[model samples]
Target: EYWWWSLFIVLAGIVLAVVDTLTGTMGMFGDSGLLGGLFELGVIVPSLALGVRRLHDINRTGWWLLLVFGFFPIAAIGGGILLVSFFLLDNFLILTVLGFAMVIGGGILGLIGIIVLIVWAIKQGDTGPNKYGPDPRMATSQ
Candidate 1:
């Protein structure tokens, strides 16, 4: 359910973006619409809601979505900042060693989080009720 909804929302966002570019209405009623924040109502809100529901279907907390999406980019940016600080301090060798370590560690963590999310999203959901809620399968049958 969420997978499909997300796909559709992403497609809609792309369409709106293209229309905005062609029409010179760079912010109207869509992703970045003339209506300002109202634009995100169609794109980000539904997508986020679907994503959260998707996580719930797998018997996981919606917070997992935040960790999955945010962990990598946040960690990687922090690592880059650390590396730049090291360079500014004139610690060349420390910059090389620690910067390399930071980047690699961030990448590893990011990859791990992505893999976990992939598995959680595709893996068969819980048979009945586990934690998040009742099995979607059962809900459909009734």
Candidate 2:
């Protein structure tokens, strides 16, 4: 139930994004100036709602999504450190090499972070229930 709704919302958001990208009118109700704000409303809100369901399914606070997303910057910092170390070594060719490497490394870390969020979402919650509320999985049985 929740999973289906979440999927629907995500797909809808994606569709809206594509349409907005192509038409530049943001769903026939927005202009370029408003696209950014409209995108947030049309996409981010429902996505967050789905995220809430995802967290609910896992017996976690949806607030943790922020933490999970925040991992990207932390990962980028680690990459930045590696980049600085390479730069400090005074190898110009390798310095440039490290820059691209850090970009890819950061991208990989961001991907992994998103994957972790998805995995966290699908993981079965407590057998019955925990702090979040009644088990979404068990709501059907009861």
Candidate 3:
């Protein structure tokens, strides 16, 4: 169920993006227009909710989603700032190396996190609810 809902959300986002691009309302790269922004705003809460539910289904804490989604982006952003600082500070060698390390490490870890989530989503949820709540499967049947 989580996998299916996640797929639907992704597909819907893709379709909206394509429509926005084709209609010249937004650019494919960066120039987001009203429609694109609205779509993003609309989906953000639901996407998070779905993610939390999915995590719950697996008997994992919803907090895992935060680590999965937040850590990498924050690291990458911090790395970017460092990289920019290195340039502004007359090419500090240490800053350059540290920035590169953070950015690359963040990206690699982010990819691994995504892959792990994907695998978990594919697996069966806890047999009879180890925690979080009752079995979603059982709930639906009644």
Candidate 4:
């Protein structure tokens, strides 16, 4: 159930990203234009739910996922600093090209890291509960 929900969220995010590109390029947002909002909503709500389920699978409260997502800006800031450093320190065009490459490559690496985290979270948890709460996959023997 959770896996399917996560898959749905990922697919919806892709669709929304495509729609957002079209809307932005066409200047389609207005009172009548809902594609933009729909795109955002398509990504956010399911993402939140998936994040919650992911934490639950790990026997952790869903709030931790919120914290992790919220910290993304910190990583972005670090990446931006590295980019600026490359620009300021590099004298050769080749080095500048490398700098751009690092930025894009780093972004991809970061995204992969996020995917890995989510995947790890969604996988099977301990046989019983650890610390967070009940084993969501099982019911108490009673």
Top candidate when judged by TM-score against the true structure: 3
User: Model 3 off-target regions past 4 Å?
Assistant: 28-33, 140-142
Tell how far residue 63 is off in model 2, in angstroms. Answer: 4.4
Best by lDDT: 3
State the lDDT of candidate 3 residue by residue for 37-108, as single tens digits: 677788789878888888888887888777777759866786876868676877677777777777777778
Q: For candidate 3, which ten residues in a row score worst on lDDT?
A: 27-36
Candidate 1 off by > 4 Å: 23-42, 139-142
Judged by lDDT against the true structure, how good is candidate 2?
A: 0.67
What TM-score do all the candidates reach, one by one?
0.63, 0.52, 0.82, 0.49
Shift in Å, residue 37, candidate 2: 6.9
Give candidate 3's error at residue 68 in angstroms: 1.5
Candidate 2 Cα errors over 4 Å, as ranges: 13-40, 61-63, 73-105, 137-142
Error of 3 at 33 (Å): 5.0
Q: Which of the two candidates, 1 or 4, achieves a greater TM-score against the reference?
A: 1
Query: What lDDT score belongs to each candidate, Candidate 1 first?
Result: 0.70, 0.67, 0.76, 0.63
Clashes of each: 5, 0, 0, 0
Quote model 4's TM-score.
Answer: 0.49
Across residues 84-121, which tens digit of lDDT does each residue of candidate 4 receive? 66667655556555555655665666576568676767
Could you give candidate 2's per-residue lDDT for residues 1-142 as a string of tens digits?
6578777766766776676677666535544224544655676777777787767767778877776667567557656756676667555566556655666776786688688887886776677767777766664652
lDDT of model 3 at residue 35? 69
